[model samples]
Target: MNKNIILIGFMGTGKSSLGRRLARRLGYKFVDTDSAIEEITGKTVEQIFRKDGEIRFRSEEKLLVRKLSGQSGLVVATGGGMVLEQENVDLLKQNGVLICLRAEPEVILKRVKNKKRRPLLSRGDLLENIIKLTKERESAYEIADFSVDTSRLTFDEVLNQIRKFLQQEGYIK
Candidate 1:
């Protein structure tokens, strides 16, 4: 059975981008949970947030996590707040190595500020919101098996760190 590599982090932390690269390197399938949720609900994430509210969107996210937990040979980029629920962490860990990607508040704000798709930052001071949300989710994100700050690291450097961790954990050769 092929184990999975699951990336968990705040928005703009390189989960999706790094997940794609990691999947390619490991010859595994890549899944962005947010995109999958969008596909499943027939609505964009923003639409879901706008129409159904965050609570409803989180419900959909949980269901998707349950579904992904049953699969293998995947690299999943999870929604920012997915790990806030212990159940989601437990389910993913059954067949996955959870890696948290992190960045400073300033870096996060710079990376995500112009992206209108981020509902959480759509209404507030971007940097302040990033800091606030980071604080709120800090403990939750600690559930990850491994973590790396992507702020000063190049893509290859970040990938190498994750690869090294995966190797140490026996998830890769």
Candidate 2:
């Protein structure tokens, strides 16, 4: 199997941006799983959450991950909560080098603040909700093959760091 580069992290951790940069640098295809889902389901993420709820969204997310797992030479940016599903994690591991982009809560809060698109954070208690979600999801994040702190790094910096890590870990030449 061709090893893929899979980016997993909380929302606002720069997965999509870094994934795009990394794919460009590495000459690979870029796949944003969230966008794929949006296209396939013909609904925005907020709409999916409001209409079908998180459980249904997650199920669809897992299905997309499974479908993408067989592809080669792709850099995939996954939804923040995608790794929470064990099946998704397993499928990602089978086909990719899982990289976790982590950031301080404050950094994430700053990056995501006033983001109207995110269904989960479209409430008053933004910081509190981020803290709660981070606490609940940290364990899943820890399962990543590599983790990078993106709190202070620019998008290019983070992409370079991931490239170095991949090379060191022999995922890339």
Candidate 3:
């Protein structure tokens, strides 16, 4: 059975927060792809987007995903747009149980509004952008093995849902 768990969803769906917690509970190392990108480039994701644009960032992401997807025993928190690339999705599936975290656009916006690192959300019309992007990404997210609506769930609640999924899937006994 695959020991890695990969979380994918729209931005502000609590992937980062939940990744850290889930990793701790399960004794796995957590990797947030965005943070890894920042570390490798020595710049924040916003800086990457500003200097290299989304295309460049995505190419870099593809390379990184190719490498990271081969690793085991990790809890990976993926960027919101990771699934836009079929290659990334296939790579992640090679050794990971992909789970989608979902939440309402209003909830997502409220959770992310204070964060300065979100390049895409920095543009005008935050709410509309959330709606648009989430709609566009719905199919990508729907391919997950399981999805949990986190709009009103607490961290523990979300974790509980994930734990249940893992148990049911026989990833955990």
TM-score of each: 0.98, 0.96, 0.97
Superposed on all Cα atoms, the candidates' RMSDs to the truth, in angstroms, are 0.7, 1.1, 0.9
Q: Cα lDDT of all candidates, in order?
A: 0.93, 0.90, 0.92
Q: Pick the winner on lDDT between candidates 1 and 2.
A: 1
Please, what are the lDDT tens digits per residue for candidate 1 over residues 7-101? 99999999999999999999999999999999999999999999989999989988998999999999999999899888888999999999999
Off by over 4 Å in 1: none
Q: Pick the TM-score winner.
A: 1
- For residues 1-173, write the lDDT of model 2, one tens digit per residue: 44999999999999998888888888999999989999999998999999999998998998898799878899999999999989999999887999999998899999899677799888768989899999999999999988999999888788788888988988888
Error of 3 at 156 (Å): 0.7
> What is the C-alpha local distance difference test score of candidate 1?
0.93
User: Which residue pairs show collisions in model 1?
Assistant: none
Candidate 3 residues 1-173, lDDT tens each? Answer: 45699999999999999999999998889999999988988988998899989998998799899989778889999999999999998999989899999999999999998988889889889999999999999998988999999999989999999999999998876
Pairs that collide in candidate 3 are none
- Which run of 10 residues does model 1 get worst, by summed lDDT? 120-129
